[model samples]
Target: FRQIVVEFLRPPTHSDEQIRSMKAKANFPTDIGRRLRFENAFCRAWDLNLPPQQQHDVRQHILSYMLVFTTASRMRGIHPDGAPGLFDHTYEDNQVVWKPAPEDAAGMPAQAYGMQNGSADRAMGCLLV
Candidate 1:
C-alpha cells in the first residue's frame, strides 16, 4: 500500500508547513486542525476513541472526520464517494459524497445527467469541511 502511494504521486504538493496550516485553521466554525491531530494517533494505535472533552472540542470532532477522509483518499481501495471499497461503514446517513466518475480518453470525467452531479470541488472540499 505504501508502495502504491510512493510509486504514483509526486512529493505531496502540501509541505509539512502547509499541512500544518490546514491543521491550524481553527476558529469557531472550523474545527479541522484540532481533529486532525488525534485522528492521526488512532490511525496507528488501537481503536481508542478520543476522550470526551477532546472529542467534543468542536475543532477536533469536525477535523477528525476530515482527517479520516483525506487519509482514506490515498488508498487504492477507496471509492470516489469516500467509501471504502473493501470495508464496511465507509459512509453514513448524512455524509456528503463527492466522487468522481471514470474519465474518457479525452482526460475528463464522464458527465452525469442527474439531479446531483459530481464536481471538481471534491479535490479541495476537505478544506471547507
Candidate 2:
C-alpha cells in the first residue's frame, strides 16, 4: 500500500479565551493561549491583541534591537554550533550581508517533523506569510 499525503488548513477561528475556557472545563488547562494571543489572521499579523494605537509603537520599539543583538552575538564569536548560518551582516544597512560559502560549509535542513494524525488537521493551519 502507498502512503497518502493529505494537506489541510485550519483557520484560526476560536479565541484564546474561548480555548482556555474549553480546556479548563476538560481539566486540561494550558499556557498555549498565552503564546497564540489572537485567533484570526488579520488580528495576528497586525498584533491587534494590543490597543490599535499602541501596536505600531510596540512593534517599532522591539524590532530595532533585533539586528543589533544578532550582529553583536556574531561578532563576539558566540555562535551556537553550526548556527546563524553562513551569512554575515553590515549594520550600516541593518540587513544580512550575504556572501558565498564553501560547499561543505553550507547549512542543511534539520529533521522533518509533523503533528500526529489526531491533531494534524488543526496544526496544519495556513498563514499568508
Candidate 3:
C-alpha cells in the first residue's frame, strides 16, 4: 500500500501536452485525474483475489492515505514558509510565534475543493473507516 502511494505520487513522465490532454478529457484538474487513474490501477492490481471485506478495507486505507497526502500538499502550497517544518516551534519574547489563524490553518485544504468548515477532517474520518 505504501509502495502504491509512493508510486502514485512520483513525478509523471508524461509531457505537459499529454497532461493537458488528460485533464481536458477528464474534465477535471490534473491532480484529480491522476488520483483516479492511480485508484483504478490499485484496484486492478490488488482487488482481483481479495475477499470482499478485505477489498473494501484496503480501498478505504488507500483513500485515507491519499487524503492525508493531498491535504498536506495543499497545506504546503498555502504555507510555503512552513514547508521545511510545518510544526516548527519558534519563540519570541517567550511567546510562540508563527501560529496560523484557525481558519487559515484549517480552511485551505477544505477550501481547495470548495468544501467548508473542516470538511477535510470529516472526509478523513469517513475514509479511515
Candidate 4:
C-alpha cells in the first residue's frame, strides 16, 4: 500500500493531467457512499434487542471511531494508522501534547485534526466503560 502511494505521488511517468484526473476521482465521497451502503446492510443483517442506552452507546462507539478515523486520515503528512498516537496524552493548558509511547515516540502533531477536546481518546474511554 505504501509502495503504491509512493509510486502514485511520483513524477513524469505519471503526468500532471493523469494525476489530476486520478485525484479528482479519488477525492469523491466514495467512503461516504460505501459506509452508508454497509450501514444499511448491517441494519438489515441483525435485529438488535439492545436497550436504548445500549443502542446509544453502540452508536457512539461507532461514531467515535468514524470521527477519529476520518480526522486522522485527513491529517497532513501522517498516515491514518499513526492517528491513534494523538490520544496518548492529557490536555495541558488546553494544548494537546504527546506523551512518549514506545510505539510512537514522535507522537501526532498538535495541529492534527480533532486534537481538540481529546475526542478520539474520550470516545475510546467511553467504549471501555
Candidate 5:
C-alpha cells in the first residue's frame, strides 16, 4: 500500500465517538466499513508470537487482518481454530477436517503491548495468548 494509504489505514487513538466522526469525515463507516485497520493487523501479527521476519510471509499480516475480521463479523455458526491457511482446505485422511478460520480472528487496536520489564530470554505474552 502507498504510505498515504497505510497512514489512512491507521486507526485513531481516540474514543469511538471520535473515531466515528473521523470515519464519517473520511467517508468510512465509523468501524472501518471493511477497510483494513492497523490495529487489527497488529493483533494478527501478535498472534503468531513469531519473530518479525517470519511474520512477513504470514499473509502480509497487514492486508489479511482486516479482511479476516470483516469475514468474522459477517459470518455465522461455529468457526474453526485455524483460519488463514495458504490453501483452501486442510485435508486429513482424505477428509476436509479443517479449513481456514480467519473469521474467528481478533481484530485488536493499534497498540503495541509493552512489557514493563522482562528478560528477553523469557517467552511470554502471545506465547500464552
Candidate 6:
C-alpha cells in the first residue's frame, strides 16, 4: 500500500522510454486523465476486495491525511506569470492564462476537491475515536 501511494505521488517522466522501463504497469498510461481514471478504479477495486477491518483501516489512513491531500489538490497549478511547468496553459494577449477546470461553477466532485462538510465532520468523528 505504501508503494502504491508512493508511485501515485511520483512525478511523471518526459521520455516515453523512461516510462516504459518502469516496473509498475500503472505508469504506462501516457494520458493524465486516463491514467487518473484507471488508478481511481484500481484503488476502488482494491479497497472493495479487502476484508472489512482492512477497509476500515485504509479509510482511517486516508482520513488522517485528508488535509494534506486537500491542500495539494487546491494548489496544483503554477502561477500565471511563472513557468507553466507540468500544467498546460496558453498566452492571451501576451499574458499567461491558466486553463479552467472542467466544471467552471461547482468545479470537481467533493472528493476530488477535498472533503465536503459532511465528510470532514465524519473524519473528525474518526479522529476522536
The candidate that achieves the highest lDDT relative to the unseen native structure: 1
Regions more than 4 Å wrong, model 5: 1-12, 28-65, 69-129
**Candidate 5 lDDT, 1-129, residue by residue in tens:** 111122235653345564344434332112212222234422322222222212212121112222211111111111122233322211122121112223212232211111111212322112110
Cα displacement (angstroms), candidate 4, residue 38, comes to: 40
* Predicted candidate 2 versus true structure: per-residue lDDT over 20-100, tens digit per residue: 444443312222111342333323311111111111110111100111111111121112232322333223312333223
- TM match of model 6 to true structure: 0.17
Which lDDT tens digits does candidate 4 get at residues 1-129? Answer: 111001124323334564345434331211211123122211211111112112111010111011112122111122233333333333222122222222221232222222222332222111010
TM-score for all models, in order of appearance: 0.23, 0.17, 0.20, 0.16, 0.17, 0.17
Runs in model 4 lying further than 4 Å from the true structure: 1-11, 28-129
Among these predicted structures, which one has the highest TM-score?
1
lDDT of 6: 0.21
Kindly report which residue stretches of model 6 are placed more than 4 angstroms away from their true locations once superposed. Answer: 1-12, 24-68, 71-129
Local distance difference test scores for all models: 0.25, 0.22, 0.23, 0.22, 0.23, 0.21
**Clashes in model 4: which pairs?**
none
Tens digits of per-residue lDDT for model 3, 1-129: 332223456543445574345434432122321123323432222211111112111011111122222121111112222222222221122121122222222223321221111222321111110
Give, for candidate 6, the lowest lDDT window spanning 10 residues. Answer: 55-64
Between prediction 3 and prediction 5, the one with superior TM-score is 3
For model 1, the stretches where C-alpha displacement exceeds 4 angstroms are: 1-8, 28-56, 60-129
- Give me candidate 3's TM-score against the actual structure: 0.20
Candidate 6 lDDT over residue span 1-129, tens digit each: 121222335443224453333313221221212012223311221211111112111011111111112111112222223222323322122121222323211221221221112121112111110
Poorest stretch of ten by lDDT in candidate 4: 55-64
Clash totals for all candidate models: 4, 0, 0, 0, 3, 0
User: Candidate 3 — what's its lDDT?
Assistant: 0.23
Error of 1 at 27 (Å): 1.6
